[model samples]
Target: MVLVFLMVNAYRELTPIVISGRTIPLKTIRKAVFIFCFALTLILISIFLILFNQGNESSFLKVLFEVTSAFGTVGLTTGIAPHLSTFAGLVIILIMFIGRVGPLTMMVSFGFRKTRAIPQYPEEDIAVG
Candidate 1:
């Protein structure tokens, strides 16, 4: 749910907004991208940590649900949280804290400031696998 909302909000932010025959420039698109990526990374890490700590005790889907719920601060659980390892429980608690404080807020609080001047260099075509 929260992940869906983050993706939707990011899409909306990336899209240009028009009002009264004028298109509003989106300067925060990078910020939106950063937030989305950070959230995704957190979710993935949480899932990995829980799965590693729990071993085969819980299914992937259940771990995913628990992590997402914690990240969303929705307080929804599948009754697996209590049985999770201490480290896994801590991970969920951290996720909940980050979710409540918000990714952007966490980034800003951690000294991620936006620069006023954006440096642009010449585009180069590179090969990729």
Candidate 2:
């Protein structure tokens, strides 16, 4: 979240979220809020959908907690870990993989963009006094 704020504020050179050709302009605060909220909603929705299909009778909050645990790569569980279906286990594994690798991947992707180009201007630097 802090990094997202830095990206939206300090790192003004990078585009926030570009899809196809539609570049919706968003300010630093708005972009941060949007990203945070959207990601939370999406994660909750995916978790709920998967658990629902697995015929769960648990409340949404319980499922959300489980989903957060998986995403956070935490070992804690509400006694539901062993009973999950194979598909659900696989999904959790995949989420765990993402939780482990996602930040590294994000850094790499942020380092390289399809629209980036070599600087056309000459470089100059100030000397330390």
Candidate 3:
């Protein structure tokens, strides 16, 4: 699943840090976030197209709004739920689950826990406004 993929990726990237006490690569985190965001965008687009093509009398904007609302776990509706087909209702339920347990939280929960050792590096303060 998605969580497995994230754990593999995180383990590969964080192994050095966990074993050698090195910092995680920022670029790795950036790339992971970018990919996740792209996937989420694609899912939204697919939902929009399907809803719009249904010709169920709901406006495209309304469909988008409902999809977002469901995905965000926000119960607001533009008065279109009663007409949605069974499949669409199922999609909404899936979205609600995704919203409730954010993708990142679920993914990160798959990682193995690390134990801390005594600190070796001294703390230094950098000037900040």
Q: Against the true structure, what is each candidate's TM-score?
A: 0.73, 0.52, 0.51
Top-TM-score structure, candidate number: 1
TM-score, cand. 2 vs. native: 0.52
Q: With candidate 3 superimposed using the best TM-score fit, by how many Å does residue 123's alpha carbon deviate from the native? A: 32
lDDT for predicted candidate 3 compared with the true structure: 0.67
Please, what are the lDDT tens digits per residue for candidate 2 over residues 1-129? 444444664556554554455554566446556556645765766686767767855556666777778877777677676777777777777667666666345445667647767779877967755
**Model 1: lowest-lDDT 10 consecutive positions:** 1-10
Best by lDDT: 1
lDDT of 2 at 31: 50
Cα deviation of 9 in candidate 2 (Å)?
A: 11
RMSD of 3: 12.8
Candidate 3 — worst ten consecutive residues by lDDT sum? Answer: 14-23
Q: What ranking of all candidate models by lDDT puts the best one first?
A: 1, 3, 2
Better of 2 and 3 by lDDT: 3
* Every candidate's CA RMSD: 5.2, 12.8, 12.8
